[model samples]
Target: MRNGKGQERKASPSFFTGEKWLVLTGLLGFLLAAICGVWVILYGGPVFPKGDVLKAFSFNAALGVFLLSTAAILPFTALGNKSRALFRWSYIVLALYSYAAETVQNFRGVDPRFVKGGMPFDVWVGSIFTFVALLLILFYLFVAVQYFRPKAYRLRPELIVGIRYAMLAVLLSFAAGVWISFNNGRLVGLHGSIIWLHGLGFHALQVVPFIAWLSERTALTHSARKAFIHLAGTAYLVSLVAVGWQTYLGHPVLEWSVLPVLAFVSLLISLAPGIVLLRRQSDQTVPAGKAIL
Candidate 1:
């Protein structure tokens, strides 16, 4: 990790870094996503499609990017540090099984959960896949619970807060996954799918945190930055609830009228704080974060 000159050398990103096998596994997820997405495209215009690979690959790609991106920050979280080796390793292995199940079985045109006929894929493989998926959810829930307290996980002030909220959202995502499983499908009715709520829940990993990073770039006070984080986080959470309610009512959130309005309005609320902060700083000659940039 160093040169002959003895200057502090950066650790190169690789398999050894923070158990980055997760990132490698995540890339495989994206590859599966691309494959399934392309398959759906070629299959033509059916919204639901013949097979359920749309949700399969969608889950892979979304969780892929999330797991991949969040791996870098694992070292920063106290629960993810070397002190908690067993928990860390267990999560990685379980996650591998869960993701691998999706990638392999989905590509084979088999439902990893619902396979029948008492074949090996159904009795053993599918059962194991279901168990692993549940285990992975518990693992993520453990993390979310641990990381919700900043004292438990260390990071920059605003970012730590964002992480707390994001992980909480991920916990909800896992909950939503369970809901979908019990319901046997994402569709709530004629047009709505809980998939809307499920998919976007994972996205909180980026949404509010990205806003935190953006807020850090302004000439705002530290307290001001933190306040903006809260505002944005609340708005984002509200948007999720609005969308969830819309989906549960068997109406697509994006459909015209109140359904779309409620979700979009919540999103707009998150933007207001950032906009106000940026506008207030516009008169200043140099932004506070210019040096860091």
Candidate 2:
């Protein structure tokens, strides 16, 4: 390939390795944890008086899903062969840290995030967990930086747009995480739960990309695809903002009001592409669009 001078040019590298292990492990963890959560919910009581372990497996299931979602997006990032080994090992360690931080700590009846304990729990486990979490945020920040590079121009327009917006939400989640660490609780204003906002921010990684993914499989004009991407991206961010606003105000996020209603409606709008895709799939009416890379 050449530029104005028509000289040969080597393509930039952005391939990700070890995504398969992350996907397989995460899926297995989710299924196993889900089964355990259900069984515990049916037949067990809280291991701790605070009832932390009672629902521990359920949250572990969610953590597993988080890993899977992260795996899904890593291939699209600008990671190169030179950095692949380090990133892959770091991800594995992070996965283990996440699993232990939630599951084992809960089983031991210790609060993973904000524990009041000593010895192995405090100096060892707690400090390491915080460091690991920071490492994850920093890792994603590196991905964000790579996405802005010219190599990212190789991405499809809508995919890149979705990735950018999704990264914003992720960064916002990191910010909320920092706030939680400082506050030592999920509670914010009044009854508002910062954790809820945090979850939404992270889940945007999956939701926004899903729309772009579906659009490639459905019959849509170029304008239509771009429009859907913008709509979903903007709507999702708006919903996040609305929730953040209400969260900061210390009110229930779903409290019946203009902001909450707007948030709910925007979320629905963001997911509308999926509904359309499903209906078309059922009716056998969706024409194939461009092949997804």
Candidate 3:
């Protein structure tokens, strides 16, 4: 009976084992939903009557959905450390804040420029939907991470520095993009959440490097992880340059295609370290001090 129990324990999942197919399927489902959203923006009928009103709706809708989904899914996949318990609660707070924002917006009016077509605090529904979507994503993300990855994963200081630097780069890039757009008077011209899309995309690009750094410290060991990170970083950098060049050429890729890709890629990259570490060792074998930051 003792031997049978031991055998059963061995058969059961450990940290080293990868997530089941179902969790991955959910991730893919979210990706598909994102694609559907993009399609609506590019080809579907306009939501608002006027041009600018429609533009804001399109932009806000897309961005709100992306952030909500990310905030929901990523906490579970990468950010579920005891240290990050604050963040988990913060998600809840943010959801409530979203609800409040919607309520206030209804009173404030959806469109400042056009009173006729707009309803008071009109974006309320969008906000509520975004918040709920975020909540669901986070719940699933948490479940996947908790079950699939080791709980006590320690992130290296260097990796933390890398994350900070990546964030700094994203901020600086966004500021530069905004400044250039403003000075060029280009900012005044674009419809939809083009600026937000650019900002989010640039930030997402930075996440790749940060993930690489973390992967080196945790999931991967020896020279293998380093090699993979270096290669992946090179690929990411190349892609960024290519995207920038395209945008500069006055033929930017469609936001529908670009934004969701950026968000998903960033989320996936951020999870690499934890996923790798969990994949390489059993839950009991993995040290307990390590936690996601």
Per lDDT, the best of the predicted structures is 2
TM-score of 3: 0.37
Tens digits of per-residue lDDT for model 1 on 124-240? 878887788788787666666665664542234456676677776777777778888888777888878887788788888777766666675666666667788888888878888
RMSD (CA, angstroms), candidate 2: 4.5
Query: What's the C-alpha lDDT at position 111 in model 1?
Result: 71
Q: In candidate 3, which residue ranges exceed 4 Å CA deviation?
A: 1-44, 51-86, 95-221, 245-293
Candidates by lDDT, descending order: 2, 1, 3
lDDT, candidate 2, 1-293, per-residue tens: 33223434344323224577777767766775876677577867466633365556766676677777877767666667567556666777786777767667666667676667544644577778888889988976877776566656354445666777788887888888887899888888678888777889888888887777666555566567668777888888888888888888888886898878988998899888767655654443343333322
TM-score of 2: 0.83
User: Please, what is the TM-score per model?
Assistant: 0.78, 0.83, 0.37
For residue 261, model 2's alpha carbon misses the true position, in angstroms, by 1.3
lDDT of 2: 0.70
What clash count goes with each model? 0, 1, 14
* Inter-residue clash pairs, candidate 2: 189-250
Candidate number with greatest TM-score: 2
Q: Answer with 2 or 3, whichever has the higher lDDT.
A: 2
